[model samples]
Target: MHDMAQAGLTKYVAEFVAAATPQDLPDDVIALGKKSILDGIGLALSGSVAQSGDLVRRHLDELGLMPGAATVIGAGRKVAPRFAAFANGVGIHADDYDDTQLAVASDRVYGLLTHPTAPALPAALAVGELVGASGREVMLAYHLGVEVECKIAEAIAPRHYQTGFHATATCGTFAAASAAASLLRFDAKTTARALSIAGSQSAGLRENFGTMTKPFHAGRASESGVAAAQFAAHGWTATDKILEAPRGFFQAAGGGYDENAIRGRLGAPWTFADPGISIKPHPSGSLTHPGMTEMARLIRENDIKSADVKRVRVGTNSNMPNALIHHNPHDELQAKFSMEFCMAILLLDGKAGLGEFTDATTQRADVKAMIDKVDFVIDEKAEKAGYHKMTTIIDVTLNDGRVIHGEADFGKGSPANPMSYEEVADKFRDNAAHARLGRSAADEVVALVRDLERQPSLERLMSLVAKAG
Candidate 1:
């Protein structure tokens, strides 16, 4: 094991990235990496139609520069690798629909981790395509990036998240840089410089959660990461100890560094294989998923009508309220973070898919009426129990004096109750169809992703994404 204490956190991560190989990744880890890639592609495809995604795409087009550098995921256009990463990263996270890193939930102070794939995959794909990297190389880069990002998140979270820093943007920048550096085949010294530069550029605020800027954070992180790696490969200089110095990342952004948490465990258990990543069943805030699942079940099992319910009560972890900040959401973006909106939509529509969280749907009289009737109550016990083991209890009161109760310990897409491969494929197809991608094209993407490690180059995959229907 590398001596992280002596090496410093940034150097340790860079060395790990430099040493990572396809052989170092276990079979299950490789499979998980592929799954995460597929999930991210699906989300990006669906998000391509989002107003925010469209805006970024148009903005990039207006520049009229950097042709043939990399392919945009769903637009059949080419831009610089950094621009491609930025645009695709936005699309992947536009609806908050990407996978979440579950290991960060272990932190006592905060329950959220960076959405690992949003930035890492974009950076990997953009750089991979730019350099004609093979599928095995791309997958290796992605795995290395996730390892570095999740470890850093584990070492500094709760404090990082509690301080209103968006981990997906802050930690994700390093994740992107690591993936880019790996694909570019940078040595440890160059990779460390990239990480150090990334540390200085890392930034995003939770205050932007409900706006388009939230997804933009992921985009900016991806862009900054590609730039950092490109600069570092050309002899850019930065402090070698950017993550552990007195005024470094953990000290300035995080309350303090937890050296013990980061060191001596580079890949001891493989974070992706242990706590794993949660592919979201709903496109909204992940913390609200369990409640959405139970509410949908209760409404279905009891044949509850929207008008029959006088009021609805939901109980979740105390910290969830702060995360789901929009109580009475007026827009689609806000609706995704609003527990009331999510619950109302699930009960009103029977399912909460990408189509449900929209401005038109959120502003509907029936949906608003239901949203008004729903109330969220923080379960002190659940909060104390911690987010990783959190549960949801939902109670519904009918106008006729009857009550319905339901509880869910884990969301459908969580590791405790994981979505089957078939389900994940179904989700991908649904997302693609929503984006108007042809059925044949969507199936080809799925097949290619499943057998990704065998491809000689990402050219075919990028071509398929570019040719989206």
Candidate 2:
């Protein structure tokens, strides 16, 4: 095996570095960039009250160290850029409602890791504001960073995901670093060094989902990425090819690396195509959602009562075991990732929304009993597909021996079946409604996001987004 470290990230990094300015991208990418920016802002604003958001904010406040570099999303306080990124990123992901990417899946990760809570956009926005970079410049850096991160993640394939690493944290560092480097305009060598440094810090355990630590992963990644870029801009030195080198990111994190997946498709085939990223219609694990929706529909359509459910069997891909498999959840956050809890809520409540996953609901005796009756079976075929084309086969066996089977492909908001703009907006409003910001603030956000590109200054965009909604 050759030394992957010395292999060449220079050319790739240089190409990305050269195209860091917003003026260098196509019109479509620019449009997508604006969309992502708006989405990230919306998600962060909504997260202000989420358990994760409040937890992070209190932690930062407790630190009592203010650097006044940038604004923390809903707090109206300025702090160091690194901490700002950390806090805001946490806010973005607080509700488990941020975008996701189906790392090993062939389908576009699409909405899984889009503008909402996107590390690249918010990271760029904060860094750009601190350094007086223009909106166009910040957008450019964010787009380029997102493209690079997606490509690297796409290349890692079955390895990156199958090894149990969250693609967002592992690949997001590069995205964050690229955005920071672009805003700072670091040279090729320094940018490459930054990528290496950030690569070393990429980490997020899949097991941490449903706890406060999940958002912590996002915060840490954003901070680490920014730190890497700053270090590189200052002429710091490090390994050049941290991605492909032996025992490098790909080899170590992803099971096996595919050089072609990373190299040949940089700008030719834009990943931003069909960039209508999925906005969350509901705040729950994306995988668990399809089943949740279907179960709710069945209960509503057939009027199946909780008392009618004698047994519930959920068949899904192997990944479900890691996502939502709780028999009894103590709180809503856990219910968010708990397939059993979500399904039970679906059966009992006829829907799994914010309220269904609340602490009161998850701990309800009826819900707990229903969750216990829920069990799962893994389909090898879906597992082989790497859970990308995951489908849920739900079997509800009633007390009357009435067997109801429901199967759905590409649940709501999937690329195959995307949510309408109104739907996305509705979701945004739902999350942001009870915040300090009122309906008018939410409406202004909707308008600003829709007309993002036409604005003369990012100040307007930031002002509207930063409104303590």
Candidate 3:
């Protein structure tokens, strides 16, 4: 074990985690915690029956792991905390419909933060349930986990992502470990040790983005976190200075480090409160959201038909195109990352939703024809404006010589254009229905999450999440 003086970045985070209490959280932060948790659970419910979720569930069954206290979301089963975390984590991100952290997008040079809740919430819920933690305890741990993960993402961002690392799986491991440690009520030393172990286990690559492996990254991160914390609780040793050492995580995984970004403010004003969370309005990449919303709006308001448009041009930041890597997607998974596919669907159907991205829909001749006419270009001005505030410009040229243009500075569901609680609940209901979970159980989950802090335990909430089918 390293001395506290030599503990470096790990010590700072561990100390904060050890010292923080539910009383330290502001009302709004607590509220945001509940909101983020609800969104993650909703996504997990929808993803439970997805291809990736089914794959992992089958793998776990093959392993024949012993049952534990934690429930696997929408699977109607119990498993060990680590397995449960892995399954639920995969489920949350399986559809690529979870929340995104755009707080660091303004740096232009740095990549965006990972989806903050995907790994953290699963770790919190699994551990919280295993330990019989209260709703407030789970919320507190969840908030701390996001805080640690996002701060690290800010510290070593664009480099971390540009280097082919998946931030959700890499940074997310630490987030999950931090929350699990909190749920386990670890001391500062143990928490720091767990984080150190987490750094060693962190692994995920962006090259797998368009496949089932993408969601698997989240699952492994969640699993690693529980394992790290559990191992630390049993007195496993690790380098407490793992985050700041010359050969540590940032040095090896990130292009470079911004010490100040990690060390600064330490929660003077919460990241969630400032940049906040962007609940998705669409199921595609967050960067493509502004353009998708605007395109749909333009088509609907102008009464444009598929045959009316000659071509569509979309302009966004340079980095925006990187996430939308699938230029000619042939599958549903690939279509989520294909700006052309998303744009084609919007122009042809006047909307893009969960049902719009599918193998059958993507292969349709009309969709293919529309995809051929959609063009994506990096706007120099928009790229110069930076990614912190994502912007999009759309210009549609009609065969009739009519041109229509629209611009969006922020996407719907952003903090600037927030979704109401009712809207979020509706999304949850729809996702639950898609998974064949009964409406009554879905409604109960929504109600329980809204009043999460008041719940005596997470038992009722977890029970409601079990798949009806």
Residue 181 error, candidate 1, Å: 1.4
Q: Candidate 3 — which residues are off by over 4 angstroms? A: 1-7, 103-111, 303-310, 380-384, 398-401
Worst 10 residues of 1 by lDDT: 103-112
lDDT of 3 by residue, 1-469 (tens): 2235544687889999888898888988777777678888988988887887788879989988887899999888899999999999999998888887765544543225688889899999999999999998999989888889888887774677876899999999999999999999999999999999999999999899778888999989989998999999999999988888878888889846777777754576677787777888778878778888788788889998889889998888887887788888988878888888888898788767677777899899999898899998898877877766568888999999899999887777777777777778887887788788888888888899999888888999998887656
The better-scoring model by lDDT among 1 and 2 is 1
lDDT of 1 by residue, 1-469 (tens): 2244455667778888898888999998887777788888888888788888779878987888768678888887888999999999999998889998886445553337778899899999999999999999999988877878887888883777876899999999998999999999899999999999999999999998778898999988988999999999889899998888877888889868667777776777677887788888888888888888788778878999887889998888877887789999988878888999988888788888888878899889999899889988897666766666658889899999998988887787887788776688888998898888999988998999999999999998878778466
Across residues 209-243, which tens digit of lDDT does each residue of candidate 2 receive? 55777777777778888989888877878887788
Residue pairs with backbone overlap in model 3: 105-387, 105-388, 106-388, 111-158
TM-scores, each model vs. reference: 0.92, 0.83, 0.93
lDDT scores for all predictions? 0.85, 0.71, 0.85
Candidate 3 clashes: the total is 4
Cα misplacement distance, residue 182 of candidate 1 (Å): 1.3
How many residue pairs clash in each candidate at the backbone level? Answer: 0, 14, 4
